[model samples]
Target: MVSSGGAAGTSATAAGAAAAAAHSYKQLKEEFVSNLSGGSVTEIAQVCAVAPVVSLLWSVLQARQSFFEPYTPLAFIVDFLLNVGALLLSVTLYSNAPLLLNLLLLTVATFIYLIPADPSIRRKKAKLPPNASSKPSPAGSSPPLGVLSTKPFLTNYRGNMLVVTCICILAVDFRLFPRRFAKVETWGTSLMDMGVGSFVYSAGIVASRPLLKEKAEGKTSPLSTRLVRSFRHSIPLLVLGVVRLLSVKGLDYAEHVTEYGVHWNFFFTLGFLPPFVALFQSALKLVPSYAALAVLLSVGYQVLLEYTELKAFILVGARDNLVSMNREGIFSFLGYLAIFLAGQDAGMFVLPRALPSRFGLSKRYTMLANMAAWTLGWWGLYFLVTNYRVGFGLSVSRRLANLPYVLWVVAFNSGLLFAFALADVVLFPGFYGATDARVEKDMYETATSKVLKAYNRNGLAVFLLANLLTGLVNMTVPTLHVGAVTTVGILGLYMVTLTGVAVGLDVYNVTIKL
Candidate 1:
């Protein structure tokens, strides 16, 4: 018979061992993500290029489906595997995927799929609407022109951004996810580095829809009204921030404190940026001048970082106070607002009505041309700002959310947009938005577009779900010890599960706003 004293001692020892193991596991993760330089701009760009390649592939297959006798399940499986599945692999197992080679191969595959003269595959080519070739319809006419209409390429852009961001957040835990693509300790670029910024940019594309409409109508909401609306809209994110903070702390989750700070998390950053942007716009009355606001904020923030001791304070300051403890989140608020505004600027120009009929180019070509120009211009500025002699002479730092970093986000995203638009021209020959209309009404909706539209419609909901599942996954699985094959399997299952939920929501016409 054991004595009560011995039993108490045994319990105490086991508790200590468990505590030590938990600490070690957390320490291991902190080290895994810490003090690392990021990958090359070229590599980052290459990795991002996969988004457009897969989006184009999906669009093509769906377009072809429009021509052929529909096999709904086969279409879904083939396109999902080829497009989303390939994108998943590109980031994980093939992180070092050769850019030029993949592009060439995919390009060849695109041509082969397109150029082949299969009698069965060919059908009556989809044409513009009967009235499409006529002068633009009057505003009040039947089937009126959708002045605020969005493009599929843009929808594809936002959906792809969400999917890519979600994939990286969880996949980075596994051995299969390349360390070079992980978020850097202080400075540089990576696939993971692009996640938050791209997601913010994606969200911003639609968030400014109301503001854009108001601007077009020459209507303005009072500052107080704007504040209330912005805050009300942001409640979900704010609540999510609180929930995440509580969960991470209460559950003793493995958190790299330096990523956000002692108390701050990304949800907080996302929650607060909009209201501040609203405040700025209300004070300055710069409605629809998003590019100007973005430039002003980024450049002003960079000045503080470069000229003042603010940079050191954020980078190496003591975390003794609330402000210091969450400086990264607090300080980066403006930079992210800048990125969001840049996206808003992109959003305004993306509408078909934003392009002039006198440009001598169709809507697709006009948007593509503008996107290419914007992308090239932003890249030019990125290089310029990065070179000390030519410009600001600062490297990209997501932690700091500096000027070059903002420029990089815009450049990469816009470049991706250009790629998507180009794909529309190649695979979808008619006006960018018209092809999608024809596809749905004339025949069946391809499962690929359905999936993308589902994601686009409920991005925040999907993001929340991804976060929850990521935490659940971490607790359930030994992510660190998992082999490449196991990691891939887990990721495939995880992604399919997410897509399924998203599709399920769409099927029921149930949208998760909060």
Candidate 2:
């Protein structure tokens, strides 16, 4: 009887342990969700409020008489304080507020900042010398800034910085610090998702610029030639992917596919899809309507994927090493291709054949109106699909690249571009005005401009460098054991180093074109 009693006690103990384990798992999952959602909210607020304001300040500084002009100590001090204030407002206030309230406040602030106080401000021109020539320069003489300028829209620098920043933030979020910051899941559309989408879209715009021009001039190459060129461009990416896969073992296969694990996504997509897009351009000669086609393709692809359950098929054996053919890595290429096509379409519209010599008051208002209209239209589409469409929501599944995800990316990108453009118009009146040739030349030569150009010139290199640094830092440090302050300091130092490298490369006129 005593032995029977002991066995019953043992069984009861085992049951209790199992119940405790389940509870712990549930708690962790809930915490993870909360943190990620909060982080995403804060990130959106920062991009909307902080990033544009900072860009405005930079534009104002760049508009000064010269890049090297001497300034009073007080001026420097004031600038420093302003930056600090901007940072605090971006991080603290938005983070503390309710998500709806935060978004509303940001919208109101953005609108106020975009509105011109005096209508005449738009007509103000850069004063020229009496003897200066007034002849208009030939169109297309100036070098294109490659669709990634701070003054115009979501620049490459901003995107690159975001990637690096997210890497650092993730390091902290993943138990590196004492307290957790907001964290998102591998599957969901988070701030990181937006950042990646933006970066990819920017790349697409840059790649398609030359092609768009060629189509416009009726100089598109034959299909065979385009295919060969694309394959040649893809070779390097293939090699890099192979090398990275061989070198970086024991990495989480899930993370690898989810977070750029040495796969040939960027390289292969650029190499392969452009040829197809070019072929479409050549065959149809439909430059104006390509965007509509792209939207149709994105939605259609998502529907097919849902009907077929292709995701389940790919994921079944994903954990095994299958190189590029793995479910997580290969399927995303289609969605990415759609994004690229969309970006190409956007580029055609945003980068017009001719920029006006002078943006008069009425013209400025018209531009603002157009910006607002485009933003609203895209965002409205995003809202409609996510709200009404079955199985549609703003989940940026990088793996799936679903329809809702594509809409979200396009909408936010358009909105950010409009915000930046408005900021530029308000902050640098002379830039959009009928300015002297020399002044215009000097404007492009400013320190800010030079740095941005340099960073953009070797964008792939910068991305690779950041990845290398992230790996090294993870290897050398006990990331989870570090303090929050220490993590921030390290992140700052790392960013500065990356910026310095880009600037140095620019100084030497070095561009690592692949």
Candidate 3:
């Protein structure tokens, strides 16, 4: 579920460099091929492999007119080298490194990069004036938590409400519709259930955009804005899907073309959030903050499942009837919406504290701290998996909304995030040191500068790319088979590559530095 950092370190020029930079992505693809073929060139391969990711992180940190902008590029190189070194050493010690170690490295590096420090390069890259008029930021901008837009609140609200309503009603229809209504096995059932639920979650964020109106006037929205942002971004894909539908036979090219399909899931849903949030700033005053939303969705849903079993008719799976399925109708969307909010909120809350304030590891002490934190986190995760011997199992998947299942996902999420935080702080030191706490000034103003600028600016694009990539992976790989453990490796690389590339391109395209 973790993704590579997006393009945000350097000015749009750097992203252009990366895009036009023939050496990066191609080299990375070769590295993947090497991994499969067992070819040598591991050292050079590793360097090329990690460089883009590091570069992207640097750009994100510098995109904001922050104190740390000067240090982003250096931070990128240092973190990149450190992560690569860590990977090499870890691999030398073992045949394959664990996921926990990788996450820890990223987390620690990111955290260390936020703190301000000394500049690495004498002549810094010239950033576009923060007030430049040539570049108009996409709706989403700023850190994930505070990310919002300046659009009318009602506009977002109405759109989101409709999407959520669609999902709820569809979910209900699938559950209770007559057999004739569902001619294709569970076609109407599964599609309506999951599709409608996800859409509603997406819609809610769109509706909530007005809450962040003050923040979204000019800046790009953060990744957390995905619940709504996804919807907005998907409009193109959705339209393309319609075109594809009308142009081609439903079963001919359409059914088989998973990779190239116009319709998708996560990205489309994530794109609408920033605009929605921008539309409704006053809304935040009335509703709970992102954290509360997460707790409300997750814990509240858990409680309802424990106590209420009114709508069990629709929740048809291995864990059916544990709690009523009816609660999931609207509440499920709420729950998912909470998680989406939480992801963005957590990123915002934690990013500033994690990275150094200036640039270039201020001192050896911070670097050591970053490394130590990562080591401890990695060790803790290793112990948990080894001691508990909890293998990945779909048993929980069948148990929709089960407490244990939910907890499991939460734990996995927290662990991964903690690890990535440590890696970011330790490796990058004070990469994105310039992010000011003054988001109330304006959303657009806040976004152009910050460690997460790329994610804010191009989150929708990145989400779209990742979703499509994920879909392609799903289409090509046998994710369900017990023997598909090897396939899991593909997800790791996919996440890292897609996120970095998407972010980089977004920054390059959206933010034109003069």
Candidate 4:
């Protein structure tokens, strides 16, 4: 009665898992050794396998000095490698070790990295006296414009840092976060899903801002008047009605709607971001930075372990609501907002310096760098995620947001942005060349410019559309499949549809370049 077939299948699965784990382990070791010192022969060989990519990024970084001014290709390479290494280590540590142990390790690593080695280390690296500049201002007490300018380099670097942070967040999600994050059916799932959709759409609005301007005044077209009334008025009602109908139909009869209702979508999240950003912008302007921080502190007060549990208990006490709404709605949501604001402020710093004439880097090289970073980021994410299959059980759920996962998510998000930026360059060549205040002039560069301009030239619309469609797909599709053939068939169909839409839109001049 001993079944040879059963034994073989088990052995195969185990072997596959072991092989995956070993590959990941090898990758981690090579990347770590390469980065810490000069890579060994084996490490170099592994890196060389991806050298075409690495060389491209290095060249691109050198060429795109305007966007990457004050940073060298070497810096990006180092950071990219570090990001990949961190993602791998985090996945390995989380999947194989106890949660508490890994968390402690992460805490230690972050603290050590963030904290200065010397307690009394001074940040000021300047050798010149504050007033030593030859061109003194009327207000002699004020620092010189160019010399004391934190506006260009500081803000630009921080913006780059934010990009890196976003990339890290992506890595975590793809690699480790999903394992620990609550399953799709977990508490607050519906609200969270909706919130995410709203946030994504709202964020898109921010991207769209550059595309929308008054013809006469050239000021950003104020949509707050229409959008505030429409979104605030409609979305809630829509959600409520949909939820109520599902409740009435009963679960057995309307299982799909009921389950989908629980999940939040990216479109909803992006839709809300712009108005929120606008509101926050005005609020921050009125208050001093310290005062703003104070407000943030107060709002963030309910985020502590005790307070969060108590608040959740009170809000969803008896209702079958997601329990972790407090965490999602408040803590993580605020973090996202902070990241967004940081990015916004950073744009101001980068835009001034990223003027076309100032962009001295060769375009081809810049594109190459972007491609390399994009590729490596994806590659790193791939390893981080697949490593889990081998026994390193990294989980990015609510209960266990491991540090490695955090880093991965941040990296992934940044990598996406960079890749998109590169795509934009290809589609809308010279799009960012215009420095004039006119949005029309700033929108296009090529003969196909009209088509690109017509399509959500703001870049936000594309993201919103994509997010909405993706979310809808996630909601409706039976994501689970038994075999490769079925999965491939479904994916192929989806891609075909997407391609058809793209081609149709292009023919109609509705397509954006990217």
Candidate 5:
């Protein structure tokens, strides 16, 4: 009996020790997460580990044909793995490397795989006589392989990218992942900022298209009428901003100066930049020239802000009384205007022209080359200004919308658009031909396409819905106390729910246009 009691006591002691160890492990995990840096090794490992699963899911759903149709299943699997591995290595270790090397490498690899030695090219070459002239054919003489579309400002690609950005922002806001995973301040420049800038710049370009096109064609309206129209157009944004601000403040949600709110950069850009740009275009008579002038003016404005220490005044609240006025909103409007003007310039170049029915390899190559040149030029300028203009205070300040910021926005947007155009050419080779209807029907009829179309159709509504849901979720849930895995699960559910609602509304032809 004494021996049996001793054995039982030993068993109980072992059980207590095991329970204590489990508790210690849980506490350690919590502490580790709380103290994680902006770019934690663990966070990087997690991203890398999950990337393949994410890629696999994306391939099955949205990237079905685009990814798998061009290559065999085995090849697709191998390439996906390699691409994800490269991306993980680049993002985690060499974050400062130029222009996301992983994406560049993947794009190049895909391009090469799709454009392998074509029998058609060999046959055409064989038919050519030995003494035939090697001069390139005229641009319009032959049917081309594919043509770049003129209306690229707010296309499905940009919309999808915006949706992804919105999701990331929501995830960060909910603390579903480590703060380092989506921390904006981690890098000198971040993909998150660039994504936001791209959306805003596209919005500016789209909003200004009609007015700029009309003015370019010498069909100018009266100044008073133009101003009134601009104001009328801005009414919706103004109302939305006010409503969002009130909701956020009333609900006592966390506030950030950069995201959408009463003082959001987007709100001020839509409300004030349009009339200003229209008036400037009226005076200049050339949209591109006005864009250049806007750049110069933006530089001057940045210098003025620096000289007067306006950023300090607003950020540090040198004067407490002026704090209520939200000088950040008032001053940052200039930078946003600069970005809008740059978009206007891009639109002037790409839009307002007859798009070719067919774009040949040579033509497409030339276009890509031109885009690359422009991207390089802007990026070089950004590098120079940011590196050398320290005394002048020029860096990628999203708040200030400085010269470097504008250049970065323009450079990255141009590069992404070019990449997307190239991808479209490869994915839908029949897109540029007279059989466009068939291609569109086949591609657009897919479930993935429908959902993307829904988001594209009601992007603003989706954004507003996300904001509202975010507030509700924060109110109801212990978001901060949740584990990372639980947080991710919640985020996924939220995004899927949002996507479903958007798709349903789209199917019913209900768009909340503003």
Candidate 6:
């Protein structure tokens, strides 16, 4: 399901002396990220396999809330280092052989999952809640282990994706980080391109439950009320955006302005998008299908690109007006909005039935299988066939966030969500698909799960720290000149810092909301 793109690097910018003086530091690093073609879907898909594969390994090895849980620091270190450590390597050193490594790991995990283990190895260890039984299951029988539910998987996914984005944001400044993994200039994808869309898509996934609930209840708020609530939720983001803009300008930071724009950043895009969705959703909710709504928006945007001047406007070096100055960020808004809607649609399908509902194993199995089917069906048949045979053969562009890009993000995220869902089914042996959150009495939590949930719970704080640290690193170190070995070491240390802080927060029961 790989997409075809224009050249390796393409963006619109003017390299004038005034602009050059205003952005003097780390010019090489700026060029390093500019106008690069990205990795293929096949390669990205291979990289994504590690998380699901590792989750299985955790299950087969009984790392789930086992005696290892007693050794808190050691368990967290072992679990996180193995999981994120492997991820770091794939996107850096072993990127060339991601498929082979992932396949080998998957094979080992599969064997361990299927073969019976020595009783000693399989013994259960997670401490149950006070009201729940702590006694071990009878010998020779599979414990009524954790019941598979969607919440834990969703939590882990959100955290993992956030961490991945954070990793790329910092790593891209270094030479060892693959250019193919960097954000594309005009049209194409790389891991970084996927990362940005994933952020927007994830927000949609969380937003959908509430958005749809409102629809189900036939509830509508006044435009002013909607704006107030949405802006309240988005203020931190807007403040962060303003701070970033000011900081970059004040420091004369070497920024690839074309990425967002001369005056825009991701924080602004994130802040602006949710409120736009809120104001417009009253009209959009009138249509029942989010997928349909996404298609309408994407196709309409594509029409503007083809028939109007929007595409040319974004691709040109026009700084004559405010709209032209922030063209990439502004023009791409509709595309992102479509991606958000698509994510919401996916949420509608995968979100388990309401709490305390009588969802059964059959339903869970069907739900997970449906995710797999959609991922496979769209990836193998719909995405590929349409990309190759459809109108004008549009390439996936994070800059444009056009039709092809929206579809790609939706398909890509569906695959990741499916992987997380599949992990629950395989790891939590006895009960599958039961929506009762409390059904996890016998289920053991893996360090990866706990750590990731911690990050998700304190996402805004983590993101701020990452941005601050990334800036510090780029300022103090000559990142563009770092050797591969040194680059890897630096990235490793960065990951350790992030993982440790997140784990500490989790350990201390810290929940910092934006």
Per-prediction TM-score, please? 0.91, 0.71, 0.38, 0.39, 0.67, 0.84
Q: Which predicted model would earn the best lDDT?
A: 1
Instruction: Provide the overall lDDT of each model, using Cα atoms, as 2-decimal numbers.
Output: 0.77, 0.54, 0.35, 0.34, 0.54, 0.73
Top TM-score model: 1
Model 6 collision count:
3
Poorest stretch of ten by lDDT in candidate 2: 124-133
Cα deviation of 417, candidate 6, in Å: 1.0
For 1-514, candidate 6 gives per-residue lDDT tens digits of 3333422222213335546744554566677788788878888878767766666665555533243445567766766765677778778887788887788777876776566654543453233322234444555444433212335567767877877877888988887778888888887778888888888988888877765566557776687887888888889898999999999998867888888788989888888877888766776648767777887888889889889877888888678888789988888888888888878777877664432323353555677867887778546533652465653566777898888888888888888899877776555544333223334433435323666777787887898899999998987888876899999999989988988898789888878877
Residue-level lDDT tens digits of model 5 in 340-458: 77776666545433333234534334455555666687667666766665433355665556677777777666666565555544333322322233333333332123444566778
Q: What does the lDDT read for residue 181 in candidate 1?
A: 88
Model 2 ranges off by over 4 Å? 1-48, 62-126, 129-187, 250-273, 279-288, 314-325, 353-368, 388-396, 434-439, 446-450
Question: Candidate 3: deviation at residue 81, Å?
Answer: 11
Over the stretch 270-348, how does candidate 1's per-residue lDDT look in tens digits?
8997788778776455544787788888999999998999999999999999999999888887788899988888887
Residue 331 CA error for candidate 4 (Å)? 7.1
Give lDDT tens digits, candidate 2, residues 217-245.
Answer: 77767788877777776677666656556
Residue 449 C-alpha lDDT in model 6: 62
For candidate 4, report its TM-score: 0.39
Candidate 5: residue 450 lDDT (0-100): 42
lDDT digits (tens) for residues 372-423 of candidate 3 = 4534643353234323356322222211333233333333333333433343
On lDDT, who's better, 1 or 3?
1
Model 3's TM-score against the true structure: 0.38
| Candidate 6 C-alpha error for residue 257, in Å | 1.5
